[model samples]
Target: MKLVLAIAPDRFRDEELFVPQKAFADAGVETVIASTKTGTCEGMLGGAAEATTTFVEVAPEAYDGIVIAGGIGSQDFLWGNNDLIRLVQTFAKDGKVVAAICLSPVVLARAGVLKGKSATVFNSPASVSEIRRGGATLTDRDVVVDGKVVTANGPFASKAFAASVLSVLSPISP
Candidate 1:
């Protein structure tokens, strides 16, 4: 089965986390929630759900793709995470899809994954600079699909973000 892994932090935007989770689940993909610690994760949109699993470390090779949900927590972890950066870089280098939305792209860029690829995020020029500095094509849109790397904007783009992920994972029957 195609494993859709959501690397959810302890605090992320509600729609950013759950919308894509629900999308992957509805698409018949086996979804797994990987958090910093194994337990219930608090969402920014006033929702709470327990993570199915937690890992102190992630190799990024076991899953078909990794979606790093973004919010305040992601911003906090955006930089200075050598491990997470290495993980995202490794996943992308292996030709595996690695996606991030909102501020998480800042993390992805810091990991050197977004360099030269088109992507989107939730923040402003400073955030785009982070990705651009990594050599990525930063876009101010709801969803940007540059190769296997997909990214979305903010909470308002939740539906489009989920649809973009679905489209990337599996295009329509038509």
Candidate 2:
């Protein structure tokens, strides 16, 4: 079975985490939820998720890929997180699937993995500027896949983003 790491901020968008995680489960892929700290992390819409580990505790080599869920808290907590950025870089360097939804795509951009790659993120001036600064060619689409990097625009694209991540992970079961 394939293994994926799902990272979310304390106030992540509910659907962005739950939707893709359910899709990964249904596909027989194992997912481990991680955050800045371990414990119960609340979602933007009153949902709660227990983070099994912290970003610093994860060993990138143990998983096939990673999924970053985005929301308002992401800007405060994840956008400039050096640990998460290093993890994203490790995943990309290893050629593993690196995926993000909504505002979290900026995390990948900051990691320098999206340079010259076509990607999309929640349409905001800050997000657009950061991705461009990282050398990404932004596109007007719900989900954009550039090699192993998958980026989605917002919570609405969670399911499709999950499917795209699945497609990129090797040896996935139907």
Candidate 3:
């Protein structure tokens, strides 16, 4: 099965995380939630879900793609996490799709990917800087797909986020 991995920390945006997750599921692509730790991770909305898996920690070549979730937890949990960075880069180098949405597009820049790719972030200063530094053309849309990397604006745009991810998973519409 094509693995679509969603990366998150203890606290990630609920809508941004799940919307794309369910999209992967809808496309029959198996998804696994990877966290820095093994415990149940809390969502930005105030609830939690169990992380069924942890980072490969060995080989990033295992997953077909990686989706990074954005939120306060990204700063708290993933700020200094090098494994996450390595994973994003590994997937990107393999020509695998990498996606990040909301305030998390910084992860893409730090991963050293998304360079010269058109993208979007949540209209935050950090996001703007990261996108520019990465040589990406930023758009003012809810969802922006630059090559294999897809980004969404915020929680309000989950529907478009899911649709975009779905389109990435299966290149054709039925």
lDDT of 3: 0.74
> What's model 2's overall lDDT?
0.88
The TM-score measured for candidate 2 stands at 0.95
lDDT of 1 by residue, 7-31 (tens): 4555678888888888878888766
lDDT of 2 by residue, 1-174 (tens): 455455565779999999989999999898899899888999999999999888998998778888999998888889999999999999899888999999999999999999999999999999999999999999999999889999999998988998998888885233
1 or 2: which has the higher lDDT? 2
Residue 11 lDDT in candidate 1: 65
lDDT of all predictions: 0.72, 0.88, 0.74
> Which candidate number would show the highest TM-score if scored against the true structure?
2
Candidate 1 regions exceeding 4 Å error are: 170-174
The alpha-carbon deviation from the true structure for residue 143 of candidate 3, after best TM-score superposition, in angstroms, is 0.9
TM-score of every candidate: 0.86, 0.95, 0.87
Q: What are the root-mean-square deviations of the candidates from the true structure over C-alphas? A: 3.4, 2.2, 3.2
Clashes in model 2: which pairs?
A: none
The collision pairs in model 3 are: none
What shift in Å separates residue 73 of candidate 2 from its native position after superposition? Answer: 1.0
